[model samples]
Target: MSLFHFSIRIKSSRLCLLNIKVYFCFALAICLLGIKAEVRANDRYEIVINTGVSEKALSVNSLRSIFSMHLKTWSDGTKIRVFVFSDDDQLHQNFSKEKLNVFPYQLRSTWDRLVYSGTGQAPIKVNSTEEMLTKVATTPGAIGYLWRADINEKVNVLEIK
Candidate 1:
C-alpha cells in the first residue's frame, strides 16, 4: 500500500480506539453515580415519636441520652419510653452510628451497664419496623427510629438538631 494510505489507516484506527475509551469511561462514571445514589437512598431514616409526646425536636445529645437509657422522662414530666430493634439490625446500627454518633456495640454496653448496675432499664426491643411503628404510635411518650420508607402518619417525626 502507499505510505499515505497506510498513515491514514493508522490514524483512523487510533481515533476509533480513543472513541471506545471515551465511551467506556463515560459508562463507568454513570455506573458509579448510580451506586452512590443507591447508597444515599439506603442511608435515609427518621426518628419517630408518639403523637402524644409534646416535643417536636431534640438535640442530638438528648437523643443519645435517651437511647442510652439515661434520660427517662420528657420535659413535660411524662415517661419517655424508648424502643429499638436488635443490636445487629441494619436500621438500628445506622441510627446508633449516624444519629447518636455511637456504635451499636457501644450502645449495647451502655444498656448492659445500666441494667447490671441497677440504675436504668434498656430500651424496649421489637423484632420489626412494623412492630416499632405500632408500639411507638400506641404507647404514650414513646420514641423510636424507623426507615424513611416505613414512616407513616400514625407517628410524629422528631427533628434532630
Candidate 2:
C-alpha cells in the first residue's frame, strides 16, 4: 500500500480507539453515580415519635440516651417508650451506626448491661416493621426508627440535632 494510505489508516484507527476510550469512561462515570445514589437511598431513615409526644426535636445526645434506656421520660413527664428491632436487623444497625454513632454490637451490649444490672430496661423489641409502626402510633410517648419510605402521617418524624 502507498505510504500516504498507510498513514491515513493508522490515524483513523487511533481516532476510533480514542472514541472507544471516551465512551468507556462515560459509562464508568454513570455506573459510579448510580451506585452512590443507591447507597444514599438505603441509608435514608427517620426517627419517628408518637403524635402525642410534645417534643418535636431532640439533641443527638438525648436521642442516644433514650435508645440506650438511660432517658426514661419525656420533658413533659410522660413515659418514654423506645421501640427497636433485633440487633442484627439492617435498619437497627443503620440507626445505631448513623444516628447514634455506635455499632450494633456496642448498642446491644449496653442494652444487655442495663437489663442485667437491674438498673435499666432495654427498649421494646418489635418483630416486624409493620408492628413497629402500629405500636409506635398507638402507644404514647413512643419513639422508633423507620425507613423513610415506610413513614406515614400516623407518626411524627422527630428532628435530631
**In order, what lDDT does every prediction score?**
0.91, 0.91
Among all windows of 10 consecutive residues in model 2, the one with the lowest summed lDDT is 34-43
The TM-score values for the models, in the order shown, are 0.74, 0.74
TM-score of candidate 1 on Cα atoms, chains taken together: 0.74
lDDT of 2 by residue, 82-140 (tens): 99999878888778878898888988899899999899998999999899999999999
Residue 95, candidate 2: how far off, in angstroms?
0.6
The digit string of per-residue lDDT tens for model 1 on 1-161 reads 69999999999999999999999999999998875211333358999999999999999899988998899999999999999999978788778877887889999999999999999998999999899999999999999999889999999999989
What's model 2's overall lDDT? 0.91
